[model samples]
Target: MKANKAAVLTVAEKCKNILASNWQCHLSTIKADAKGSKGEIYTSKVKYIVKRGKPYVWVPESDAHNVNAIIDERGSLAITTPFPGPLAHLLKSVQKLPSRIALTGDVVLLKEKKAQLATEKLEALILSEQKAVNELSYTVRGVLSSTNPVFTSRSENLQGLTDGGENYNIYKFDLRSCTYLSGTGGTHEIDLGELQTSKADSLAPYSAMLIDGINQSESRRRALVLFCFTYLNARVKDAYILSLDRKGTDVLGKVPNPTSNEQFQWKEFRFTFKEEAPDVEALCCQLVEMEEEAIKKVSSYSGLG
Candidate 1:
């Protein structure tokens, strides 16, 4: 049977509190066939920890059997105290074996016994994968919500990047390395690599080019900035693409006031192509780099330096 949202949240809270008190929990996996007719059951003892208010189940490296099989067996997880403890009471309360509990979090397989924060583990996973801009954007949002519950509770309609009531002139950069006269009546052949500052005034034409290439609405642009930066790094206030070229891209944005939502300061970041020039993969690398930087900054800020 499908679990409702209220049931999921209630179970999550109960699991969190149980882990906080017991430091470990028994995880029973119930696997059902594709037709939802019959199933098998498996059980394991896992160390549990609460990080940023979320409960994560950790399986040690020494474990002989892999839990992935059961976890992937198209089933729900029923968590309770281990045998001989309150297991009887727990099972009696549910009135069912392999009870369905919908949990929204992660399962970590650890190589070492040392306990690490969930945020740290997530950052490590994201960095190791080197996800592209679009993938990184979603991953950053997930990390933000998982690490900071308060962020998810904030009003969704708050003013942000797209709300800035200023008209922006967009520009595009040419792929070639040569100079060409401007189309807007200006006689200047621009060498993209030689461009220095990514400041709005300095990069007017180039900025316009990057902005024009984006097909998303203004609201989406604001949401993208929040997803790609601020949400990933609490220190980041905003993010905006300044320019894009075959070799690199520049971004201009803001850093939030950790103390107040009404205050934010502007900042700029540049990403150079990691792969060969003119390849679409280069853009992917650049976007991944942005996410890596945000993760790094946030990690350091949290005293994980």
Candidate 2:
């Protein structure tokens, strides 16, 4: 139940960042009165959106979890960070495991004005984020755009917000407690107040873009090696950017054995920014400055400065 008060993002902020980046969760709930299944707990994968410190999901009225919500309002959601495909090579390392979070709370169906407003907000947010349908190919996008019952019926049900029509209903999962498991095997209990007030990392949504771009560019990729050599004094090869946040970035590299130079070992290095960046533009500027410093140090050491 200890908290990592010194970490860049408190346990709560990391939780919010992971939740906002991912749009789906494993939802679990108790079963309503139905024959022998009456007190059983059921788990299902569902799409959700975090709005104003709350997670909301749209489900069919007849869905088992929805029915369960009517009788027992207790529920929980589990979310895990997805490891990017580019980093698949590091999968064997235990230190590179994905971070996970579990939240327990009350599951209540929305009503009246709240339902109406949540519907509008949910649709707008989902469409804006596009995480739900971001993988749609051109053909699939075209099919969904056409006049079809599959598309039309879903739109109709979505419009019937307050009453939920005959098909769908909206439910809000109110957060009561949270547990966060870090990538390094540490666990912490998040404070509800911190969870309520913390904002998701500003660069989270675009972090993948940044990492991909750096890995693709030769000069940028070499900059990582140069920085490690200059600051950490470690000669490395096959280095790549691992993760990025507002405060700093993590890089993983293969270090060669000094004696044999035949065996290679993997090591992780962190570079903290001179100051916290408010946006990507500032972040890039800080990195460029660091690269310049690294180059100067390397040149001076080689007596070429």
Best candidate (score: TM-score): 2
Error of 2 at 305 (Å): 4.7
lDDT of 1 at 110: 39
Which consecutive 10 residues in model 2 have the weakest lDDT in total?
Answer: 146-155
lDDT of 1 by residue, 96-198 (tens): 2321122322233333333334435534433433233234344333322222221211111111112344321111111222222211223333333332211
Kindly report which residue pairs in candidate 2 clash with one another.
none
Taking all chains together, each candidate's TM-score versus the true structure is 0.24, 0.72
Q: Which candidate achieves the best lDDT against the true structure?
A: 2
